[model samples]
Target: MQPNFFIILSPAALEDLPATYMTSFFLPREEKRFLNRLLSEFPAITVIEIDAIVEQIQSIVDRVTQAVELVLALVVASGCLVLIASIQASRDARMREHALVRTLGGARSLIRGSLAAEFAVLGAFSGLVAVVGAEVTVALLQSQIFELPANAHPWLWLLGPIVGAGLILAVGLAGTRRLVSSPPILVLRGTQ
Candidate 1:
């Protein structure tokens, strides 16, 4: 039985309780032989090996960790795909806008700054959302599924936005580098 299911009481207070209640023990490897002897001599006595329980718990934790990692990788891959598709879909319109901006005295630095700012805001907002979602999931998993105390990870607050902004900036700049660097006249002509 889990510790959560019952409260400890004096023997006299539990006189009405059944005799079939269980007691758990922790013993060293050498002492396990003592437990085995006791179990074999008394058919009613049962001894469960802690090593087996630990191995089972570790296996479950490992499976859950792998599943979470897989989900995260899939999310990142899908986000990249969506980002690329959005950029490609807007390429023609963006080229025209870039040409117009440059034609009206806007420098390449202006376009670069505009692109960087757009990506940075998107990344930061997404990161903030991801952090919140992750913390909620963790709280649920710890308190309900694992029956453990819930704790907050402070590092997520710092790392989430930083990583998000960095990733978005790298991909966004790579995709838009040509828009910022191409000759405005050539882009205008191509658009026409």
Candidate 2:
């Protein structure tokens, strides 16, 4: 027999297909019965090959995943740079605070502890805001643009906040090391 002709039928053509062919795709029960009748009359017609459809879907999924990964990497890198710059700029203020603590008889270790705690709180707050903003954006896009269900995984919420907080904490601590190590008097004099 000749290669099966692929007839791409619209939803309106559902009533014309046989039940056997209709069952291969997602059709209502009523549509399936009507299709069964048509297929019984025409044995030559087969529904589209499922394997080909699956392969096409998989290819699309792979491309989408790659694109998403690339975008995510760029976003993360940008966030890191912004965080580093913000922390670096605030070093002088932090050093002044550290110097005050030292003058008040706080040890260097205690000064470091205070800085870490401040950064941790900042990280947590920033993470919370970022997560909420992202969730709202995704929800809006799904409902308005995609016209699809807005179901986000729990892990997304958890991961975003955790990652954001961790990134902030890591960058803050690393970037402030120089300020933390300087002499308290120099920091207070604004000489460093």
Candidate 3:
């Protein structure tokens, strides 16, 4: 359909304002012929293909998503290194504490359970914080960056604590295995 507009605006009011005027055409078929005719009639008019523009936008979004994923991977790796370092730094303290516990009539099984519980609690708390951060990040990325509806990952809430606790427990137990197995006398002697 051909559309026309007759605007009567005085030039003095908007003389300094730069404006872009666009005319849209709706066609059932023969769009190429129509565009060619329109272009031939108006050579100064610029024609932009909506489909091409959309493709370019999608390509940009894909690249951005990849970049975000890479950043997330780096962040995870950094967190892992920090966790290991902190555990290593506290190794001596943990050994001494275990020795003291043994001296105070704590059984090996009791020590193991307490250690497991501590690690699990730490992991769960961290996981909760991580989940909260993740959810906020997701919400911001979706609504602000990606221009999409915010998603609340309910399943993530359920899984985060369990996964965190399991991972921390496993790592903590592995790092402290020798501390539990060794006699308190040896550990106490080393600390001296």
Candidate 4:
């Protein structure tokens, strides 16, 4: 006859009884201590091995990490697209204005300088908005999320808008070359 062996089970163990029982055997020292403490209060039970608990925790971590990385990639792609579109639109808009300026006796260098100045102003404004938005976003996230710490840096805020403005200026300059080279009469007539 087999010796009667007592089994200690947790609430989670009861839910997964079939699987737990399939792997049930002798308990480790830590598990035995926990079981003894549990059994002292309750009567009948089954014990879950530590290996299963460790595996479940590891699975949860892997899933969460995968989800976070997917979200991060999506955000980066969206930002890149927005920046590209903004630069393209800015270049198109400035090309027409630069053509008009050249028609009205504006020097080529002056037209370029004016566009650069406009871009600088836009960049400064965007930088200010980004800084403010970052502060507000960080504050809100810190207040709402559990176990999350505020970790905003000033350089990121400064860089984003400066880069945006520089990109816009660069694209605008590239697009205006044809307009700048055209004769004033042709520019005025909108021929090319």
Which candidate number has the best TM-score? 1
Write down the lDDT of every candidate, Cα atoms only: 0.87, 0.77, 0.84, 0.67
In model 1, which residue pairs have backbone atoms overlapping below 3 Å? none
Candidate 4 off by > 4 Å: 1-100, 147-152
Over 4 Å off in model 2, which ranges? Answer: 1-47, 145-148, 189-191
Residue-pair clashes, model 3:
0
For candidate 2, the TM-score is 0.66
Writing each residue's lDDT as its tens digit, candidate 4 over 1-192 gives 243686777778678555423344666656567777876786556555667788999999899989978996796457556655665676545556777787677898997687677666765666567578768787777867644777777787778678657755565556555655666665447564
* Residues 90-111, model 3: lDDT tens digits: 8788888988999999999999
| lDDT, candidate 4, at 19 | 44
lDDT of 3 at 76: 60
Could you tell me which residue pairs clash in candidate 2? Answer: 17-35, 18-35, 18-36, 18-39, 19-35, 19-36
Candidate number with the higher lDDT (1 or 4):
1
lDDT digits (tens) for residues 1-192 of candidate 2: 243667677877788765433344555645656767877998787765455678999999899989988997897788779878987787778788878887888887887787777777777777778778878888998999999988776777777667767777788788888877888888777778
State the lDDT of candidate 1 residue by residue for 1-192, as single tens digits: 355575778999979867765777777877767876787888887667879889999999899999989999999889978898899899989989989999999988999999999999898887888999999999998999999999999999889988888888889899888878888888878853
Model 1: ten consecutive residues of lowest lDDT: 1-10
TM-scores of the models, in the given order?
0.76, 0.66, 0.64, 0.47
Clashes of each: 0, 6, 0, 3
The root-mean-square deviation over C-alpha atoms between each candidate and the true structure, in angstroms, is 4.8, 9.4, 6.4, 11.0
Top lDDT: which candidate number?
A: 1
Ranking by lDDT: 1, 3, 2, 4
